[model samples]
Structures are given as structure tokens and as C-alpha cells.
Target: MDWDKLRIFHAVAEAGSLTHAGDQLHLSQSAVSRQIRALEESLDTTLFRRHARGLILTEQGELLFEATRSMARRLETTAARIRDSEDEVFGDLRVTTTMGFGALWLAPRLPRLFERYPNLRLELMLEERIVDLPMREADLAIRMKEPSQADLIRRRIMEVRIRLYASRTYVEREGLPRTVEDLVSRRLIVQNPASPQVRAGGEFVQPLVAQANSTLTVNTYFGILQGVIHGVGIGSLPDYITAGFPDLVQVLPGLESAAIPVYLAYVQELRHNKRVCAFRDFVLEEITAHLRTIAPASE
Candidate 1:
């Protein structure tokens, strides 16, 4: 029947009264009651039972309510998609990434994006927390972990290798750790000691002693690399961050290593947006081309 009648019926079912539904829909109370009456007549069923305070849904009304809710949700999603399509793509591109990668790698590369699209603005949120893309918390994100949800589209950018490193001065003073057992006694700068993934074997690398006895504890990879530069204790750092540093030497070259996959994620529906597509392709191209030069050879 009439969509407007169904709309009014849905509103009244939700609000429990004609007056309340009228207030919500910005219609007169009489208009709300008329629409509900028409809908009831069209359906040939008594949708609501009259009560002293308000109305209560009948069994048929309850069933209709569930179906109507689904319809409303689908309609709202479709309308939002249409509106987003009609909107211009010259707005800000909000991106979220880890602090270390954002600062050390992506921040420097953003100049090219700005140069290409002078009209678009870029806002970077550098935090470890994964921002919700479908909720519009962020337009895009570069994450170290693979996404578990199927609603978003994920593209693997590259395979990242973590290498243990120390400065030449530290190596000379503390003596280089030739074996994994030697690493246990030596000082180490850990990024996140609390992380289960950071543990090698049964012994956890204590950053406090590693800092006091050897170097320092830092949360970001950039900070760890800097600590290693100033002759801090040995630390594990991503290959991309330490690529150009002259003083940082690979510690325990073959014995100890961990590799993690990096991904570029975005909402599946937004993939077709012109600006989004352009940025996605550009990033994919850059990462694919540069990964060979920067990524460490797989062990």
C-alpha cells in the first residue's frame, strides 16, 4: 500500500502513541491518526490494542514491526549511499595508522599526495587503536594486523620483517650476542614488554633493566631506532624505519627474527568513490614498488 501510511504506522508503533509519533515525524496528531487508520484498514487487521496509557502491539503488529524495521534499515542505508555518491570528493581524507609508521614512513610520503590533489586535505590520526571505518571514524587505515571482519576490504601492502639491532659502540662495549642464549643475559630495548608477541622463548625481555642496565624503553619504533642510534641497548625494529640509518647494525642476523603482514583497509562500499579509488591505487603502487628495496629478505 502507501509507503507514507506504513511510515506513520512504523512511527506510531515505535512511539506507542499518535501524539508522540506526530511530534517525532513533525506532523499533526490528526494526520498521524488518519494514516494509522488507513494502514490498519489496508492490512485488514487490528494492529494495536487500545490501553489507558498508550497502545500495545498485537501479535500481527509485532510481526509487521519486525519486517518494517528491516525495511527502514535497508531504506536508510540506500539513502545514505545515494547522498554520499552525490557529495563532492574535495573534502578531508582522514587516515589512521600506528605512531611509528605514520611518523617515520607515511608522513614523509604524504607530500606527493598533497602535490597531486591540492584541493583535498589530509588528517592523520597516529594511534595503535584500530579506528572504525564503516562508522566514519576514519576514512582509511594502514594496519599491521589482518582484519577479522568481512565488511571491509583489505589489501596486503607488504610483508614486514623485524630485525634485532644495536649500534657499533654498544656492540663493542657489551660484546655482541652471537647466540639466543647470549641475548638472554644482554640488555634490550623493548617497544612493548606487555605484548605477548614480543616474547621470544620463555623469557620476557624486561625493558626496565634493559633501559637502566643498557639503554631505554620506548613505545614507538622510531624511538627505538633513535635509542639504538645513540648507543642504547639492542632492540628489534622494522626494516623500513632502520633502512637509511648508518650506525644501526643487525644483531642476531639469522637466529632471531619475526615477520608480520601489513594491510591497507577501507570500507567495501567506499571502494568505488573516485577520490578513494585514486588514493588506494596510488598507495598500492607506491608500496608495491618500494617494498622490494626496503623489505628484508625472508629467512
Candidate 2:
């Protein structure tokens, strides 16, 4: 029941040796062994199985280690919250989103955020895997679909669609197609049909890939964008990417995928945290500005 003993047990279990754990804790091996013995006495259970090579946890030790690991994560979260100044926005903020958006949109705009709060540190995780916000896998997430996970505070931020684009140089050389059928004569660049992407994008991509005279398939939208930018071919890319790339000419203005809703979410506990709120506000403002620029006539 002693917190200090539990701490020592955690370290010993992690290190798998009393001597190693002792070195880390600034205690001698004898002292570390004494504490573990006391903890085992209090719990009436063996925590580890000694081996010639090292140590391995017993069944009981695994259970205790699970609790300790959870405790460690929660403690880190608590410490981060405590570090925040209610009136100031500056600290380590982990933000997760799709690779395409992170690389093309959010990452480029982050400099302004830094200018406003020089102390603000950001960890941008760009992946398809949905991070567990409540469990603190990430401090916040910007995802293509609404997060169905629990204990999350979510806001619908924007809508995006897969659309066709090509570099101005390509358009000048190959000429722009006026209709879907017109694309049959041109080289079509797109996301690989096998890659994990939004349903709308995947659906839109299949038909185009099937009929083009020539094709280039990239695994990511970033790769497709590069091909389009460098005049490789007409590429299918998310519309939001165009906000930052003015040189990319929309090949067929009328052709696009159904709108995919984008959501920004965080653990409910972070709703009032200064750094979280500041980052959320900054993103919303940027999204608004982006929407205005992308669809000025609609607005």
C-alpha cells in the first residue's frame, strides 16, 4: 500500500533487474530488493520470477504493471494541465491529422501560430490511425470523419472533396479537358486504388483510373500532388490542398467527390485548457479564412 514501494516495483519491473533499477533510482541493489520484499509481503504475492538471464513478471506483477502504466500516463496528462497558464497559450501540444492535410495545409500555416506564441511547441502526427483522445494518445485530432470515440469534444470544421488538378505547365502543354470523357486521351494521375483513403475519394478514383490513356498511381495524396505540381500528369487530390497551391489548375471544375466532413476533436477534459482552446481557435480561424478563399462565390 506504500506509494514508494509501488514506485520501486514499477521501476524494477520495467528494468527487469534489481541492480539496474537501483542504479536508476539512486538506491543500492540491497535497498531495492528490501523494498520489493516489503511490497510482496504487503500484497502476499510474488511479483517477479527470477531468471539466470534477468527477471520476468509473474501474473500478479503484470496486473500491477498495467495499473502503474495507466497511472503514469494519467500523471503526465495532469502535469501538462498544471503547467498551463489560464491566460497564456504556450506548451507542448500534440495534434494529429491525415498526412495529406498535415503536410499540405496545417504544417505550412503553423508559423503564424508560432509567431503569436513563441513558446508554443507542437507535435504533429500525420497518420490514418485514429488516436485515442481520452486515453491521451494525442492532445487533439483533426480527422476526415467524425470521431465516434467516447469522452471527446468535437467540432465540425470543414468539408473536403477529391478533385482533379494539374500544374499550369501541364495544362499549357497537354491542354485542359472540358469533360470527363475528354480525360480519356490524357494521362491520369491518382491515389492507388488499394490505398486506404476516404470512401468518396476511392470511389471517385476507380472510374478515372480505369479509362485514362495513361496513368500514374501514388500511395498518398502528397505524392499525387507532387506529380501534378511537377507536370507529371493530371492528378486527383483533395480540394483543400489547392488553398496553399495556387499554381495547381483545377482540370475539371464540375467534377468532384461528395463532400467529406472534417472534424476537430479533443478529450472533453481539455475543453477549458488554455493551450487547447488557443489551438482550437487558431485552427477555426484558419479554416474560416480558407473556406472564404476556396469558395468566395458560395459565401
Candidate 3:
């Protein structure tokens, strides 16, 4: 199989027009068409059918499309690894993390990472949205949810314990709740549910609060934590997030604690690549060691 012809076929299938594909690949439309024709000839099957607007993949093309997509991803990963190997381990390491984790945990610890690997350049992208790893949007991600993609590698870093907490001022003013029923009478700070399960939890938990009206509703957990810090209302926050805050008091200690698993995800094939591997192992070690230092004796 001619890799160049396959590349042209992939570009055409993706772009849906020879002209657009040619523009992207910096080749003439005629050259792109020729390559596609050669690929079809070699395969002895029609790959694409011409449409009024663009080209549509034929049934044969659909099968080839799947294989070609995988091939392209592998090729890109291989090329990136080759380029990385030739250069110093000093290139940018793009990381995506939730705002709370990045701000309270990862960001502070990054100085140590830099001290260890002085040559590695770090770019931290803090967001609530999970960046697309396979698209090369991010090199690594630390997320609350498990990645469902089979092509990506995922490791369970640790289980984060989330508990309802309030500032000392709020607790003193509102009076500490003796039971879950007491929560129903006080103001609550809540985060918008990122998943259906979290929404269900919110629905069940909200009824316990007396006011039912949340003082603040934000998309990110960090926002919820910040609101709690300013005496907004009782909010559920991860232990790791609140560990550094001196004034935050845990409310409903045992009843409100929920365990959420954290994960580290990256491209599967890039697992063996030197720089990627180094970062991956470094993160695992840092997070696991941190957990060990803070976790209860039983944990």
C-alpha cells in the first residue's frame, strides 16, 4: 500500500472535497484526484462516490476509512515521538486540569516538577472542559471522570473524598447542623452537575437544605470552594482542594463525604515515548505520594 496515496484518500474523506483537501495538503486538486484514483486502482474498488457538494465514502471506503483513521493517528504519534527524541526534553508539556485541582494542587507542586526536570517546558491549561487528547489539543489531563475512549490510556491516580464545608464565619452565624435535616434550613452553595449521576445526587441532596435556593451556582468546583470561603453557603468540596484553606470547616463530617475517583489520561501508544512517559510517571508518583501523606491510616 502506498502511504502517500492513503494520506490523500484520508485528506479527501476528511475534507469532503478534493479542492479543500488539496488546499490543506498544499497540493493541486488534480494531484489529489490522481492520488485518490491510484489508491482506488490499487485497491480494485471504488473508494468515494461524487456528490453535488462533495465526495461521499462508498461502503468499501467506509471500511478503509476506519483503518486509515487508525493508521493516521499512529503515524502522527510516531512522527511526534521521532521529533521529540531528536530535540531536548525541553519542549512544551501541555496539561489540562480542572480549575480547582490545578489551582490548589497541581500548580503549587509544579515548581518541584520544574526543579526536577529543568529542561522540560510546562504549559498548564486550566478548564472545566476535558480537552481532546487525540486531537493533540493537550498532552496530558487530570480529570474526575474516567475516559471512555479505548485508544487512550487511563490510570486511576487516587480517590478524592468530597465533603460539605463552610467558612467558620458561616458556621458560627448559621449554627452547625446536627443532622442532615438541618441542612434544609440553611443556605447552600452548589455546583452545576457535569454529569447525569451528579445531577441525580444534586436532586437528592438539595431537598435536605431548608432554603432549597442555592446562594451560588457555578460550573467549576473551584468556584464553589471560593464561594464557601467567602461565607456564601455550605458547599461540597474535595478534601485536597480544601486542605490548604485554613478557615474552611467541614460540615456534616461523615454524612456528606463522597468518594470521587481521579484519573490521569493520555494517548495509549505514547506511553512508551520518553518525554510522555516521564511526565506520566512523574504525575503518578507526585499524586500517589501526596495521597499517602494525607490519607487516613486505614486508607
Best by TM-score: 2
Q: Rate the local accuracy (lDDT) of all candidates.
A: 0.75, 0.89, 0.78
Q: Which parts of model 3 have CA positions greater than 4 angstroms off?
A: 1-88, 193-204, 209-214, 297-299
| C-alpha lDDT (0 to 100) for residue 255 of candidate 1 | 45
Task: Report per-prediction Cα RMSD to one decimal.
Answer: 12.5, 11.4, 14.2
- Worst-scoring 10-residue span by lDDT in model 2: 81-90
Off by over 4 Å in 1: 1-89, 168-175, 195-215, 295-299
Which tens-of-lDDT digit does each residue in 79-167 have in candidate 3?
88567764345657888988878888888787777776787878889887768998888988888789776689898888776678899
Best of the candidates, lDDT:
2
Quote the lDDT for 87 in model 1: 35
lDDT against true structure, model 3 = 0.78
Q: List the residue pairs that clash in candidate 3.
A: 183-209, 184-208, 184-209, 184-210, 185-210
User: How many pairs of residues in model 3 come into backbone collision?
Assistant: 5
lDDT per residue for candidate 2 within 175-234, as digits (tens), equals: 899889998988888888787788999898788888888999988889999889999989
How high is each candidate's TM-score? Answer: 0.60, 0.71, 0.63
TM-score of 1: 0.60
